[model samples]
Target: MMAERLRHDGVLVVGAGLAGLSAALAAAPAKVLLLTEAPLNHGCSSAWAQGGVAAALSADDAPELHAEDTVAAGAGLVDPEAARLLAAEGPAAVRRLAALGAPFDQRADGGFAQSLEAAHSKARVARVKGDQAGRAIMEAVTVAALAAPHIQVKTGAKLVGLLQDATGRIRGVLARIDGQPVEIAAKAVILAAGGIGGLYAVTTTPAELKGEGLGLAAMAGAVIADPEFVQFHPTAIDIGRDPAPLATEALRGEGAKLLDGAGRPFMANYHPAAELAPRDVVARAIHAERAVRGGAFLDAREAVGAHFPEEFPAVFAACMGGGIDPRVQPIPVAPACHYHMGGIATDMDGRTSLPGLYAAGECASTGVHGANRLASNSLLEAAVFGERAGRAARDERPASGPYAVVTAPELPDEALQTLRQAMSREAGVVRDAEGLGRLMLLIGDLEARHGRAASLAAARLVAACALNRRESRGGHFRADFPEAAAPDRTFVTLDRIDPAGLRYAAE
Candidate 1:
């Protein structure tokens, strides 16, 4: 039977986040189709970001400094070339966003109003209003994308698998649009579908992003790199919300202190950088604080004070919604799963292990964020690599071909809840051999029950890799192996998840 395929002549971008949208926009005049699980301006982490993009745009700062900071923050295993690419081309990406009408905050002197974030060497994070950079930038980009003539947006399309031609080259995806399975064949497939934040019980990302792109690519035989390194944001507002709201790290950069339940400042006791410490440090600190009787909190009253609404609208609204006043009450905070530093391995030009398969943004581990990611670099990476992927795919349109449809396993609600609980309990902020082994057991059980669900597939990759690595480094902290060993990075394919090997060689 002929595949029920939807064929597009140009590039097919699987996702509508910063990377996907940016790719579509960059692949101008080429017929670009963006397949998203959500509508134009919703369900993407990019829209929820508050700290804004990091670039060496300030006159006093340099890209070399930014690159140094990125390497320092990545713990070990950060690719020098990726950091160089991000640092060198980041300013241009931000400039292009500005030209596209992004409402970035500007100084009185008319330059970008950049702010300091944790682990960054300088105040290089550009903002919008105060904490509205992500939403504002995405809104502007969405407007531009909608106006673009060559781009087509397909909302409500969920990708399940990748398609391959007879020669085993990448072509497109198998997606379910409006609940109907359909094959999509294109010249090149760009997987910008974000990360695995939604797989955790508590996260700062939309629940829809359950590692779909990463899982799909892995299932299609792409080289998955560093799947064990997951970054937990230190200050997710602990308001008992499903997708916890974030207290922008810029608040800490502006002097907000991390406190405990007894209204005592605590970050200074943990790290010299205190609240401005690296994200992993802060997250572990918060987790340790919570482990103690004193629960973690982010006290930004002194930082934003009466200007909370203007300086951080999203946080102000979330606090108000949760019946907390940021001016008086120290917002309850905890380490929530915020970002994934590991994903489908790709190159500087966004080429994955498979030909015609490319990835950018959170889904692609371009070796930029090795074990831990620098604050505000995620958005910069999306812009820099997304454009590269777009330009690469623009003229590489392949011959139209057939595709295969592989549907996701039908996971019951209870099984998903079990998976979430297991992920949080075992793979949350810290890890150990026992916990990882238990996690693998649960993943195996879930796989047996659900028959290869994409979420479980991705979750298993993380657990299996985390189980194999025996040293603490970057975002991956093993309580059993608290010492950092020789620096290394993990590279795994689909068949190796039962037991993935770690490599110490440079890529």
Candidate 2:
């Protein structure tokens, strides 16, 4: 079918999460067209984030300390320069949101209230009334984006393909709107689509985020970095929900305990810091406990029992809806895919390897998240690098040439479910050569049957990369290898991947 073509002499932004909204807002007087697959405050992970934004906000903390924690959590592959930049700009990013009417909780001295999470040396996470940070922050940003004079938003517009010129420069996007194809042209395009959590059967993110943006960029020959590293949040409330509700790590920082089904604390046996250990350590410990014991649970009865309603209302409500009052009973927990540390490789300004295209938020890897992400830094990266992407993208001169849309076949629902289950089984918290090889075979079979859908492409990248790395480091753990190798990052373009079978390729 022929696509209906439209042209707008400005910048086009994809996805309506924090990153896309921030980019559109920062574009200022320049006209901005923002497109999303769902309504504002829906489908994006930003609104579901419970732990709040990480920043060096308190008197005792500095950006250097925050950077140190970020690097430590990333497990040796973090770029020091990018980590420093993210930490240094994090404070101002949090304050900027507050200025835009985000209702962040404050202290008696009118300072922003903070909380400590796993791996942070200081109480640096600036939050709302506990778990309400993502929702509250998104509400404020939504209002601002809607009110911005230069920004026009089109909700329910699903991105399907990228429009590129002959020289390999991105010119615009091909979107499906109301079941019809529409090609929208612009000077520059910023992709802020969320992560690949939907690829796993059990994840803490919305089901719509299947890494389409990452896949589209890769198919267009953009560099993908560390696609193997997938972060599993240690404590997703396992209430038989499709997308599990996350019990924020801040609960642990607030003194929650990880206990086996036998009612015994087990984190002490896993690491010295016990409940305060880094997220990767805690997640693996929980995974091991769930295998030995019937299940693992987060016990907050002694920590925030009566204060649950006031402090973590979101979690409290979710637990109640799931027929468990968090105040009295322990919340059933599991390691669920929470974040993707790898994505379309970009610089601090969100500039991708491909010209005329930029990326931000979870879809863009600025190297701050390395092998694993530090807690609460996702939102900060969205605001800081997103603003830079907007400012940089706005300067692109208009191009007047014929552009072609790169399209991929859509996978059916059943096939998607099959892929998701395999991902959680083979590529979940702990990985091995056998499981990874099986996953690659499964991906190849699915693609052969359904063609190279974006979801499959993204899944293939993760499986192939995980299969090749052969060492346990951070989120991409290999039980067979069982140890860390010399620190190095994986970078690949889609063209380098073998089309017929399971294989890893490089630049």
Candidate 3:
């Protein structure tokens, strides 16, 4: 086990997507060791994002407007301060990404081209091509990071657990490289490891990212916030793909409508905004439609017509592979798990409650998203908070002391699969008290069997939280109790999981 004692300088960033790359770049002049479970360009949800980044880049738009839209979309739980920070810094983040060579679509006037997404009052999302914003932005950031002298990238290294010192402060990470565990000690660690979408049998995230980051942080006793709120994208191409390909919201933005099997537009009956409603509303509408009308579809023929392939090559290719033509007919769509709003709780500066551990990207709950995330705000959140965390980590120096690596117990394959299925069925798009209670019982059984596995730890947090929240709100919909109650954010920790009541300190 000679590989067990390697050390690194600066920060150890787990996951090498936009957030990790952005963090590495922002911590420039200081050395950074970036690790990825897959190759540089693969296994990241950032590449799968098609809706582009939300920012107020137009003269007619303002950050205050953007903040208001975000709060409205979040269904009354969005932190006002976090929303304000995201709104204020959005333009600068988009501009910086553009400066790194992101080929964002531009208007004839040379300003950034913007489009409307669901729930936004104005057309403010900056895009590339049509749905290529994620890939384009990632490509640009990867180029900059690869060229940066201070960044050292290690591909195919999967983070297994966090390494904490005697006092429970994080010191480094334990990673598995080529089937061997290696310990790398650093001053600070940033967990940017996406979300729990992959935990489901069907998702929009890469299959490999099965909530390892969230599980690892929870096992290390980190404060996990809003673990029950998982966002399901309302329009994933229902082509029988295991990890379903996405149909961009931009198609709907361009006037495409959601229809049923008989070719009838159906969203108008669900919400006044129809196709332009926030994701939670749209996802529920689609789910209800499918439950009643067999399935839902996106009709893009008149909206983009022959321009579909050139404008949105990814969606076009996916449609072609399924023997469907977006130019002629509607693309079949269904609601699928796409993002998670709950994760390691962090401040605006991306510092977690634990001293030496920080988080960014989808894995950090800065309270900006609350119960539901606004469209295209995820990429903006990653960029803005990634930079903040990087700068803060770079300014600090590690104390001089000997540190020991702490390893959590490993989970078996069967136990992991059981946990995933439980969470997917119970705490999924729609839930109820009976289902959540069954899920909590299953979690306890799995934890007892697996002896405190990280996967069980994460599953318990989600199940417990979902069981506590009695009313439907945002991404968390209850079929039995299907109404919004007094608006408030729900927070939970491991100690709060009880048979009597779910209790955590009131924020």
Candidate 4:
């Protein structure tokens, strides 16, 4: 079919999660057009986030302390300035969400109730009814976006390609609205799409997210950062589900234990902090224990117990529906791909290498999350950087010139499934040069047979970068080289992905 052309005289935002909504709302006085592949409150990883937003909300907590925790958890690759910026603006972001009608659990003294998770020194994660943080916050933001006068949201509009002029400046996007091809021209394009968890067979994110935004940006000559750093959640409830349900980390924060299949606690053997160690440590521990012991489980029977429903209703429902009761039994758990610590390279204000283009949220690597993300910082990054991307994009003038859409071929369902399984086996948690090389071969075979789909581009980036990085650091662990190297970040464009010549490009 011939493509339909439409011109949007404002900023175009992709994905409708926290970041996209925040960007649209922040682009006040400048009209905004937001496009999402899924309906509001679904598909996007934001609403399914069980952990709350991380912020220094209490009197004893400060942004500097929060920044310290973030930098420490990142394993030395975090941009100190970006981490400080996120930490400094976190409290205001949480308050902004609350002002939009999100009913966060508050203390008796009218303060934000906080929980301590993983690496944080303070109980600074602001939540709602224990584990409803993402849903509650997204609901409020969705309502506000719907009511806003300057924002126009179009659901079920899937991004297929990016539109760029002859000078290689991004002008707009090529999307499919209900299977009909439509070309949208805008002043600036802000990519707020989520992560690449769906690329793995076992994951905690919605299956619809396959790093298309990241791939499209790279295809349009934007730089990618740390494509090999994928974070796996340690407590994904393994109930034979495709996209496994997540058991909130707060359960461990509340004193839950990680036990082997024999019901013996095993985390103490992995790290001194045990259940509260950094997420990568815990995930690797679980992966190791599962290999030898048949399984690893989270025992919340004594921690939350009778308060399971009230404390974590989502976990309780998922367990009950899967024939496991958290009140008395341990929930079977495994390391599942949860977040991408890498994406389109962006500055603190969300500007990418290409002019007239910006990126935010999980899709953009603003250096707050270096090799591994600190727990609960995902939502904070979305709100803080998403707004910055919005304001920055609002200042762009419309590009003059005929635009061309660089579209990618689509991968069939069978090929996608094959790729997912391969990714889980080789690149999911622990990786090595041998396995990464095998994965690269498979990616090349699939691309040659199925054409270069966006999914293929995303997977190729991860495999290529993982193969090039020999040393283990944070989320990008290599079993062959299991020690830390000098701190460095990886920056590559499509043209620079020569694996034999690739190095960790330090900025």
**Which ranking of candidates, highest lDDT first?**
2, 4, 1, 3
Clashing pairs in 1: none
Could you tell me which 10 consecutive residues in candidate 1 have the lowest summed lDDT? 498-507
Local distance difference test, per candidate? 0.88, 0.93, 0.86, 0.92
Residue pairs of candidate 3 with colliding backbone atoms: none
The C-alpha stretches of model 4 lying farther than 4 A from their native spots are 499-507
- Give each prediction's root-mean-square deviation over alpha carbons: 2.4, 0.9, 2.1, 1.7
Off by over 4 Å in 3: 1-3, 402-404, 409-415, 499-507
Model 2 TM-score is: 0.99
Ranking by TM-score: 2, 4, 1, 3
Q: Highest lDDT, which number?
A: 2
| lDDT tens readout by residue for model 2, 1-507 | 999999978999999999999999998788999999899999999999999999999899999999999999999999999999999999999999999999999999999999999899999998999999999999999999999999999988999999998899999999998789999999999999999999999999999999999999999999999999999999999899989998999899999999999899999999999999988999999999999888999999999998999999999988998999999999999999999999999988899998999999999999999998999999999999999999999998988878888878888999999999999999999998888889988999998899999989899999888988989999988999999999999998877777644675434
List TM-scores for all candidates, in order: 0.96, 0.99, 0.95, 0.98
Per-residue lDDT of candidate 4, residues 370-480 (tens digit): 999999999999999999999889999887888788889888899999999999999978998778778878888888899888888898889888877879999989999
Tens-digit per-residue lDDT, 1-507, candidate 3: 655877676887898878888888998888899999899979998987888999999999999999999998998889999999999999999999999999999999999999999999999999999999999999999999999999999997988778787787888898988789898888889888888876776688887777778878876778888888889999999998878999989889999999998999988998999999889999999988898889899999999999987899999999999888999989999888899999999999888877889999998899999888999999999899988888878876775467665555667777767766777677787898888888877767766676766656666777778777778999999998898898777655565567332333344
TM-score of 3: 0.95
lDDT of 1 by residue, 1-507 (tens): 234767789999988889999898888878999999899778899999999999999989999999999999999889998999899999999999999999898888999999999998899999998789888889889999999999999999888778876666788888878888778888888999999988899999998888978887887788999999999999999999999999999999899988888889988998899999999999999999899866988888888889898888899999999999998889999999999999999989899998888999998999999899999999999999999999888888577545454446756778888888889899989998888788877877777767888888789888888877889999999999999998989898867654321222232
